[model samples]
Target: MPADQQRTDLLPADALQGKQLGLSVSESPDLDRLGLLDTHFRMTLGELARTVIIAGGSLFYGGHLQPGGITNFLIEELQRYGRRDRPLKVCLAWTVHRAMTQDQIAEQKDILGLFGEIHFLSPVGDRLDGPVNEATIDDPPAEERSRALTGLRTFMTANTDARIVIGGKRAGFQGSMPGIFEEVLFSLERKQPLYLAGGFGGAALDVIRKMRPEYAEWFPPAHDMPVPDDRFLTALERIEEIVSAVQWDGFENGLSEDENRLLSASYRPSEIAALVGKGMGRLLV
Candidate 1:
């Protein structure tokens, strides 16, 4: 294929009417090198959201790699090209007791104010307490945090039309890699349109490397990609070991009953997008 033809856009314009589009991005430390790829991906997302709904996790919304460091970038794009009769909606999800501080939550709320709805996923007993600071509160157990995050991810996947995972470093440790991995897993289980946009090296790329090595030609790692630290390498090795041990049936058996239920309710992006194009309206509410 010619290089121009090879540089094809993934989603067709008419395919996005009222569907929900999810974006999963990494907060990689190599921001300078990855910025270009991030910009292009964001632009593509912006164009796609001219009609469809765009949804993403809060962490990526405020990350430095995003041009302008606010979710407004997406909102602005939607406002620019979206129809007045049927405005595009933006959806953001965040956890109540995760690594984010109260100040961070307030900041995110301000950005979300310019766009659409924000979903604050939380546990039953956790309450939003006192003074907001820059520091993260570690009150929740690791297991609780993981489960809560996974549940939120499953909900997002179940509700969204498609998901696009972009950029990052270590497969399991760095930044939002674990959450991204979990989201990808849920998308896979639901058989949603999950596109791994691995222009910058990250967990999305790492998983592609692990599961679909033959497609490496399509997504090469960044030229100046930093070497993984010992911790990252250890985590990667552990992931390889786990992947080696688990068969398809065993992997399916590992999920909890709730996860199974969420997967069962999920819809394909194209199906939802088609429904939207035909005036069935937004299914994400």
Candidate 2:
């Protein structure tokens, strides 16, 4: 059997036994204020990566072709602890754009060398420029961009066991909250565990406000300029509507066809690590 087929053949329980953890974060500057770049967050994420590796699992992260950010830091940490015997199994989902020059592509390839599995989600055809940050640059029409975004979400969802989203700006125009929201919706529908860390307040905070309003106090004050409740609500409702309108077949990943599973929740980093550790133990035993 082919390698990809062999991977997809594993039962959901067996896949969970591998303890794969996905980390999703915003590239917005607010992440810095949230202390996501600090030693504590790095140490925590590194420790979690180490724990997952030691348990014979893998780590996955997705992002644009940039060098510095939470993704780079995570890559560094994983490389530090990566062992040849166990090999720090890592996967990267890189968003490629038409604007990328040959040099840029080479740089991306060099960076991807650290990962065990690499997946590229690009536009359907050559366009003038790529989607800038969260918005399109000016070339690709809206419909084409939409298709690319959908494909990227589907690919990421099918390839990971669980997801962790952190420090997203509330305003979609300011960051990639729209895409992240869609990913969260997909993961929730697939009955995959989701950890939303909104300590700095952004899209994650907005999600918390909508999904679990009672936990309002748990989130910190909005680090960036505060987005008004009315404005945030409007965007949230729009995303929710999009999610509801879609009829997901739940066949993207090779898990059981049972769609009734409850597999999403909000939690802190420590709590997330603990839950992952517990799940790994149970599945391995």
Candidate 3:
């Protein structure tokens, strides 16, 4: 049976609730704002009973290509609070833009199990079809990964009654969000609250503000500088530090050519630029 089918009790106070705020990234400096990130972090962790779902392919699956240190932080945090007890379910929806070996799949499994179930929505690759241990692998045919976004959007909308948290894997996912903005609007119309996890910038935010004025208040005010005490910002900074350091640091010492290719492909400059902006700042301060 699906996990959703199981009988569930009213969520505890610390569990996730309906109608919460989301974090949109714009500039690298925005991540330094202690005021904004802090509040978002508390809301994320405090609302334990809520389901926190993140989209995008890079953040969760990047470890297959390189030592994506950010993955470890999320695994550690999820392990710290054992999802069975906490109200949170961190869903990592991955697109199989790159191929993986069975051994690679095993590693992903281990990391995913630390939290709730890892659900893989990879377009069916011949390589990834067999006995993977951890994630519930949904291997669609070629080109299906892109199409699956609709199914993904449906899952988000249908599951709104539960204390639901939603985010994307990286900035690119947010860039793509406008393409699926209608789905988002429908979900929000149904009162499904989502967290815009990837970093945002002023220009991109202006686009968003114009796109959805009703939800404009949901975003934190545009700050020329960051707020110092934000927990979510702190977390974001820590994450950026880890990912950035690994990107250029000595972590690539042992990776294969394929692994290196995956790493290189993950950082699509055009996509990232379009998502955040040509002069957009990173989540890292």
lDDT for predicted candidate 3 compared with the true structure: 0.32
In angstroms, give how far residue 14 of model 2 lies from its true place.
11
Q: Per-residue lDDT for 42-115 in model 3, tens only?
A: 33332221223211111112111235333444455556545443222232234432244568756766656635
Q: After superposition, how far is residue 85 of candidate 2 from its true place, in Å?
A: 8.8
Clashing pairs in 1: 168-202
lDDT of 1: 0.45
> lDDT, candidate 1, residue 59?
17
lDDT of each: 0.45, 0.50, 0.32
Cα lDDT tens digits, model 2, 1-285, are 752343223223233445566665554335565555545445556555655655566666655556766556656765676543332332222234544555665665566465443454555222223233443243555565556666666666776777666545455432223656666776767766555555535565556556555555554555556645464566577545544665432222322212111112222345434444444444333
Q: Candidate 2 — which pairs collide? A: none
Pitting candidate 2 against candidate 3, the one with the higher lDDT is: 2
Identify the runs in model 2 with alpha carbons over 4 angstroms from their true place. 1-19, 27-44, 84-97, 122-143, 172-177, 220-235, 238-272, 279-285
What is the C-alpha lDDT profile of model 1 across 1-285, one tens digit per residue? 652332222334444444565666654443455444455545544543533543221112212212374356765664565343323232222334345666665665555454544454444222224323546655666556555555556666766665655555453442233656656665565555545544444566665566546544444566775666565555455545545554221113222333222222212223222222222122222
Error of 1 at 259 (Å): 32
Error of 2 at 117 (Å): 3.5
TM-score list, all predictions: 0.54, 0.62, 0.39
Which segments of candidate 3 are over 4 A away from where they belong?
1-71, 82-94, 122-145, 160-183, 189-191, 194-208, 211-285
TM-score of 3: 0.39
The alpha-carbon deviation from the true structure for residue 127 of candidate 2, after best TM-score superposition, in angstroms, is: 19
